[model samples]
Target: MGREFIAYIPGQKDINGQFTKANLGRTLGLLKKLLKGGLYEFGTLTAAYNGWAKGSPEYDQWMAEVAVYPTTAQNVIRDAVVNALTHVKGSNDDPIPLTIVWEGGPEGVTSRYEAAGPSWTVTITGYPPPAKSMLAERRDKKPS
Candidate 1:
């Protein structure tokens, strides 16, 4: 089974201080460019819009699914996220928040700008759940 992770990247704003689709695209593009040659593979990229109906929200975000080897370490994932954020933010002072959630569990990393510079928090409290067995599922199902 392939281990897939999701990257949630906040959208950037334009000169007018507004979150435009163009800016969001640019942000995703930059992230993709920076994440190249990493220890993982890119899946698909999508946009997530958080509006009033969804609750209190500021702007939309981009979601990218990344597939990594089962043996990949948490540090490797954290480094990829940090590198992407560093390149995307560039000289911009605004803080860019990026999060990567591993499949099967809550293990993940959250990257953000701090007073000392870029920083990331890793959470690996538990191991990922084992993959479901097809035979087990078949046995549980009743024959028609």
Candidate 2:
């Protein structure tokens, strides 16, 4: 079975404030590869793009809540997303930072992930539903 989900990419533009079409394309492409590479399954996956024109929303509703499978699938997807986004190059051959925000799951897991040149940060939270579902959120990290 598959699940629906959403993913957000922060700072949609290059350092110069110009739209980075290649960066966006590469990031989404990497995610697609993960989906096709047997990492997990997704239904209702959508990317809320921030266009270069005026009145473009700045980073909040970058994505929406959707579904995802395996419950633990996020960790795998995060690892790949961070790796791929960090490596994405601009027209000037510079690396770009990617901050991905995702929400949705059986228990509603929400995550905000970011990775820059040599550093990365990932935070994921799963909720306990008022009503039980077939899947439970996975929390493997110890409290800091």
Candidate 3:
């Protein structure tokens, strides 16, 4: 099977900003909100939109027929988001993909994800989670 691009689930979906999940940025519309919006947690929004090259529906479907690689996921998201943000703000600040990670400690603690670029590898190291769930939250724009 192929690895597909998807959002990293940080916590929950309805828990306000506490919960996090991966968002599929298949369109410029989604990128606008991510850039103008405040990123939850450390780099939730940043990583969520670092590359903005998340594959399109047609491309993704074709890849599924062949294979998928989340590594490429970040690229798609980053490109799209950056373009959207640039068009919106008329500025530039390239960030990496949203690696919504949760590190568990004995005393009810969790660590933020790394800010390294696409080249660096992220690994969760620490105490086992008593109960944890990181999820991505991507939604289509509301009809206007």
Candidate 4:
């Protein structure tokens, strides 16, 4: 026998089927919401993830754990950045202005000239692969 060709795995599917841009977009939007609500901390997300509902133990716990509000923090940082950016000069002696803003949430508007602080910007792309079973199910389903 030369090379062996294996059959499909039980719970693995191609990358197109599992995670999707829509899913990622929604997740990112949720993160932004959490951020604007002063819920940037990982613990806050964890609490929200665990479950967040009114009059429930999980919600209460999340509230307790989430101490900071993202809006306020972002505001303060933006103010400082704006003022500083206006003053920052390039090597040529020209002033180096800047701008930074969050894309969604109540703070939806962009702040003119620099962000509150140095931020780690990222562009997340693509979706995760689906499980084989899920793939099969999708394939089996009739077009609708």
**lDDT of every model, 2 decimals:** 0.33, 0.34, 0.32, 0.34
lDDT of 4 at 90: 52
lDDT of 1 by residue, 18-93 (tens): 1233344454454454355652232222222221121212212111112332335545544544354444455663
Q: Is candidate 2 or candidate 3 better by lDDT?
A: 2
Error of 1 at 14 (Å): 29
Superposed by TM-score, candidate 2 places the C-alpha of residue 75 at a distance from the truth, in angstroms, of 1.6
Best by lDDT: 4
- Deviation in Å, model 4, residue 142 alpha carbon: 46
The residue-level lDDT of candidate 3 at 86 comes to 37
**Model 4, range 1-144, lDDT digits (tens) per residue?**
111101122223221121232333333444445664433544333334334445555445434423333555444443433233223335531223222222333422233332443222221112221244433455567596
- Give candidate 2 misplaced runs (Cα > 4 Å): 1-21, 25-65, 88-144
Q: Estimated TM-score per prediction? A: 0.21, 0.23, 0.23, 0.23
lDDT of 3 at 62: 32
lDDT (Cα, tens digit) per residue for candidate 3, span 40-123: 122234333333234554334333421222434334433433432233223643333333233553322222334343321222
Model 2 clash pairs? 3-67, 4-66, 4-67, 5-66, 5-67
TM-score of 1: 0.21
Model 4: residues >4 Å from true position, as ranges? 1-26, 29-47, 68-144
TM-score, cand. 4 vs. native:
0.23
Q: What is the C-alpha RMSD of each candidate to the true structure, in Å?
A: 15.5, 15.9, 15.8, 17.0
